[model samples]
Target: MKITYLGTSAAEGFPAIFCNCKFCNEARALGGKNIRTRSQSLINDDMLIDFPQDTYHHFLTSNIEGDRIKHLLITHSHSDHLYPEDLVLRYGAFAHNMRQERLNIVAGGNAYDMLSKTEQHGITLLKISPFETIQLGDYRVTALPARHAIGTGALIYVIEGEKNILYAHDTGFLFDEVLEFIAEKRFSFDLISLDCTNVDIPISDEGNHMGLPNIRRLVCRLNEIGAVSASTRIVINHFSHNAAPFYDSLVEAVRSDGFIVSYDTMTIEV
Candidate 1:
């Protein structure tokens, strides 16, 4: 499977639209991977994860055939992840692709509530729950509860196909239930993308975001449970402007620790 990171920043984006901070200033000056948009990704060009407001930008910049996307897997109801209003463009009257298959949108209850209200045409909504698996084309996907924004029913996904990819973003640490579920299943992932929102924060049991320290802890825990081996590629993404280090410095710091810091338009094959 091929994974493409459409955007790699947190909700407000790196060099946020309305910020004058030094970090944002530097990001703007040193534009490249440092200029990140809201987080989102696409798998095999057909399956999409999260519909951030930057979807159009990704389509144009990445040269992707936006209409070819057949499935959308929403992680939560956050505006950065689930921009339902843009989905209206897929309606028959707006888009001229009637021959294409209907788009299947999968999400948890909270996200579903918002997506379902959108005007539908060639779209299918599937409300998902943690631990339940749904088959879309050749891939089998399962949603895991994310301990973010308490009661939001935020989710992280585990996709199984030619390669297993565990997409864990917008969550600080794995919840006990999710840990137990993975423990019981003994599933090892080929690639695991983790949230690195608090990149510079030293140590704290922060509930909604993760830093390098928390990442180290999670890696140890995953290893202890035999869920990750040396061959498992760990990807760190979903950065926030609050992360103190600049893009280059941050990459240098984390690369040696066995992580692939994702950037916009970055692609990886597994």
Candidate 2:
């Protein structure tokens, strides 16, 4: 499977929309990979993960046909992840040359509520729960509880196919149950996407986000649980401008740790 990092920033983006902090200023001045939008990704042009407010930008920049996306897996209802209103474009008359098939939107209850408000036509909302594996098209999707946002019930997803991938973000540490669930399944991820919202901060499992040091610890735990191996392509994404070391510095700091820093429009094959 091929995964495209459509946007790789945290809530306010890398440089942030209105931030003037040292990190944000550096990102703005450096440009290129330092520049980033909200977090969102596309898989093989047919499946989507998180429909951020930057979906339009991603569509235009990546040159991906919005209508071609057959399935959407939402991690949470965080504004940076799900903007249900934009989905109205898929409705007839809003877009031309769209396929007649309904877009399968698989998400949790909160996301479903938000999507239910859209006036979009070609849409089918599928509610999912933690640890429940379901077939979507040819892939088996397993929803895992995230340590972030217990009230909203955020989730991390594992997509099973010829090449398996675990898309985990907007999360901090792995819940014990989640680790057990992954261990029980005995599945190893070919690619693992993790949230690095905290960047170089010292916080670990205490916060709702993870930093570079925390990431190392988490990856070690995942390895011990047999969820990842040395061959697994690990990528860290969803960075906040408030995080330390900016982009280039942070990349260099974590490079030796075997994690690829994600940038907008970056693509990886697993």
Candidate 3:
């Protein structure tokens, strides 16, 4: 499996538009890894996780062939995550012959509604529920409940192929139901991409996000449950500019604690 980190920032993006905070200023000046867009990922050029407003920019920056994506897995309906309007571009008069295949878009209830409402073409929307496994070509994906929102029902996706990956983010602590579900499956994860929006905090007051301490606890728990092996890779992403630490500082801190801090355009092969 090849996972490419398209954008790694939270909603506002690091170095938020027109803001002049110290961190943002430093990030803007430093460029490179310090710069971040909204969160999104691509797997082996076929599967995509989240479709942020920065999708176009990501494609341009990475030189990605957008047409190569066959399946799109959405975690929720947050604008930073799912930009349905972009799907419309793949339809009718706007889209050229370059993109002709119907893209399969899989998501939970609210996300499904958002995508279904779009007057678009070349898209097959699939509404999924927690614990339901769906097969996409050579991959198997299972959606797990995310303790983020009520109407939207965020998700943590388990993607299996030659290797298994757990995409867990835009969320806080794992729900007990999710834990029970994992216990029953007994599947080991080769990679875990997690939420670390509040890297400087002990706990996140918002139910939708995770902090450094909670992430550490989650990692310890995963290790205790034998969900992660010695070779398992853990990546922290979806950062908030309000998180205090700057990009380089954040990377150093997480790296010292043995976790990879994901940056924009970072790619990993499993």
Question: Which clashing pairs does model 2 show?
Answer: none
Candidate 3 local lDDT, 18-124, one digit each (tens): 77899898888888888889999999988899998999999999898887789999999898899988887885576667553878889997888888788857788
Q: Which stretches of candidate 2 lie over 4 Å from their true place?
A: none
Put down candidate 2 lDDT per residue, 162-218, tens digits, no spaces: 799999988988888888888888989999999898887677586788888878988
Which residue pairs overlap in candidate 1's backbone?
A: none
Per residue, candidate 1 scores C-alpha lDDT tens digits across 1-270 of 899999999998989889899999998999997899988999998999999999999999999887788889999999889898888888656788554559899999689888888888778899999899999989999999897877888999999989999999889789878888988988898999999988977546557988888888998888888888899989899988888436678789987797988889999998
**Highest lDDT scorer:** 1
Count of backbone clashes, every candidate in sequence: 0, 0, 0
Cα deviation of 264 in candidate 2 (Å)? 0.5
TM-score of every model?
0.97, 0.96, 0.95
Over all chains combined, what TM-score does candidate 3 have? 0.95
Arranged by TM-score, best first: 1, 2, 3
RMSD (Å) of each candidate, 1 decimal:
1.3, 1.3, 1.5
| C-alpha lDDT of all candidate models, in order | 0.87, 0.86, 0.86
